[model samples]
Target chain A: MTAPRSTTTNEPTDPYVDLPVPDQRKQQSWRAQGPIVAMVALGGAVGASARYGASMVWPVAAGSFPWTTLWVNAVGCAVIGVFMVLITEVWAAHRLVRPFFGTGVLGGFTTFSTYALDIQKLVAGGHSRAGLAYLAATLCAALAAVWLAATVTRRLVAWRQR
Target chain B: MNWLLVICGAVVGAPMRYLTDRAVQKRHDTVFPWGTFTVNVVGCLILGLLSGAVATGAASSHVQLLLGTGLCGALTTYSTFSYETLRLAEDGARFFAAANVVASVVAGLGAAFVGVSCAEALWA
Candidate 1:
């Protein structure tokens, strides 16, 4: 005679497909994140300093638009794209370095705040068309530059890998 | 009287931006740059709100500098966003590149408009 059994039944789980498992390798790799942050911060400091220097060197000329800011943003965007490609594909840079140079430095170097301020100043000064033109150029050209940098990097990397 | 406040505001705003970017990156390990997008949109909105407030005299110059220059300046990042979008296109993620551009500009402007309108209404 069989004894009365409990109603609960446990099903066998597949370790690979059904069970949630922590990736130790991924976690270990992320140990590099701290260094990345430092790199980014360093990059930020450099970028900010460069921006200040640019402003001082090229004080706004008597113009309808703020040329200094436009130049800085455009240059910064292009540099960042180039930097990303160089570090990621060419150099295969350490992950920690990315934050400092890419996120922190270049990120800090570029300034949307200044961009907005410039636009406001232009609008306030009744140079609305100039302000709008500046905005368009910044948005479009910056994006294009980034795409170009990335494309160049990818092709180079592919050639190397092959 | 107010310049001190602006300085302090900038100090707080810039670091906050750095931290936020880090946090977003941690959560999403993809190279698509969700963090930059979020920061830019939020920063634009805040700037718009501050602009409206200052124009309406609802906020002080110090407050404006703190929130607008320091905070927003630190928060929104065009360089990184541009870089990442370009990276995606280069990596053959054309769809993502297109989406990033459209979404960032549209959302940023929309957020700014809403922020400005909200501030104007409240101050008025």
Candidate 2:
């Protein structure tokens, strides 16, 4: 039971191996990707809006741990884990779904830039302990959340199939 | 007004990130996630600049909301970075996993600090 589960081997070990090349087959421009762009854009807007709303509800004060951001990132990581597991192992979701939810919404919802700024401010403001604690907690919790969600989701999917 | 701007900024930032990550990853064939790292660093720089402007009264609150809270917020992602790092460690590449975490945090902070400094120099 502790052995590593090799569920999906479809993804390249080096994910960057399949770079998009110029389409010699057609004279189509970058407009061909317009639909995906729109999907991502819409999803991003919604996600960011939700995050802003969350911040408004539980605003982060100066020199304090940003609970909102931490929670958002952790939740986003877990959701992404479950999402990827379902998409890869259980259901073949539409291509647009991945871009909209995985890339756009979840990506927008969980921010690295603000986290960095928060850390800088905390350290500069003499809240180094809180900053360090926040950093460690965010990293550990997020990784754990994703690992747990993905593992459980995968197992559930397998159980259902059996 | 702030809400609208936030949405607009995210509309542009999110897609820009998606495209940039795709383009960058396509060019490099490595297990290390240089694409996400690049975006996060760039976002921190922009956020730092925005913070500086806000602090110096050079920009309005609305501008900060739009650019910093909205654009930068959507552009950089902690989830993907964390997930990727975990995956690396799980795959037995413990060295790369540690490198990812350290490099991202250190470089992101450095970039934000630089951004603020640049903004102060220009504004003040």
Candidate 3:
């Protein structure tokens, strides 16, 4: 495994980072969640598979930028933004449908852990410039993608009603 | 095949993430997105360990796909993190929003670095 580079941060650590909070939602019986669990699992499998396929199609060399992961995350983030508006505002679909698509499919498709690892690899591999560039670019692009997609989608929806 | 492993691993991982997030979110009323933060850090740690194992030949590529690619990848999410942070900023929680991004990124990378170091020590 690659050794960690000398990246330093002096940010004060929060003690409540892992603190357990009190449960506020009503407890649902496990029996009522059988179908919902199934939908998420099925959707997750498909989403992960698609991600794996993308990586395969556009394989990355070691210590290089991970374009496939970036593309998947950015695209997934945008889709989720647009999807939330549509499901909440436009469509009155089945309850499980949102879980399957939004929570399951899109959630599974976009990954945060891999993104972290990629950044770590890039930084540790003596490519700090590339790593920093990636970090900023991804954060900006993802947020922009979501905001743009949602704004345009909302406009389109409003226009349709006019 | 790797495909099968990915499917099976994700089948379990995704639901586990949902359940864990739900369970964690239920306990806290904070808008800090503790659920996503927890999962992302934990997943990074696991993936780092897995990467170490693969490097030391303690684990194979197939195992990496099953656990790292499928489980860890599906378990943690960027979309929710991004969306939550964006929402927090839009809602005038700039400090919390900035804290979320910095904390998640810094803590995640630190956890992963530690994990990799631990795994390397074990295999050494």
Candidate topping TM-score: 2
Write the residue-wise lDDT of candidate 3 on B1-124 in tens digits.
8899998889988888877876765565565677788888999999989887887889899999999999998888888787777766766667777888899889888887887788889985
Ranking by TM-score: 2, 3, 1
Per-residue lDDT for A30-110 in model 2, tens only? 655666778878988988998999999999878888999999999988998888778666786676787788778988898
Please tell me which model should have the higher lDDT, number 1 or number 2.
Answer: 2
Best by DockQ: 2
**Model 2 C-alpha lDDT versus the unseen true structure:** 0.81
Candidates 1 and 3 compared: the better one by DockQ is 3
What does the lDDT read for residue A122 in candidate 1? Answer: 68
lDDT of 2 by residue, B13-63 (tens): 999888888777666545677788889999999999999889889999999
In the order shown, the candidates' Cα RMSDs to the true structure are: 11.1, 4.5, 7.8
lDDT, residue B124, candidate 1: 72
Q: List runs of model 3 lying over 4 Å from the truth.
A: A1-28
lDDT of every model, 2 decimals: 0.63, 0.81, 0.78
Indicate the residue-level lDDT of A136 in model 1.
85
TM-score between model 3 and native: 0.88
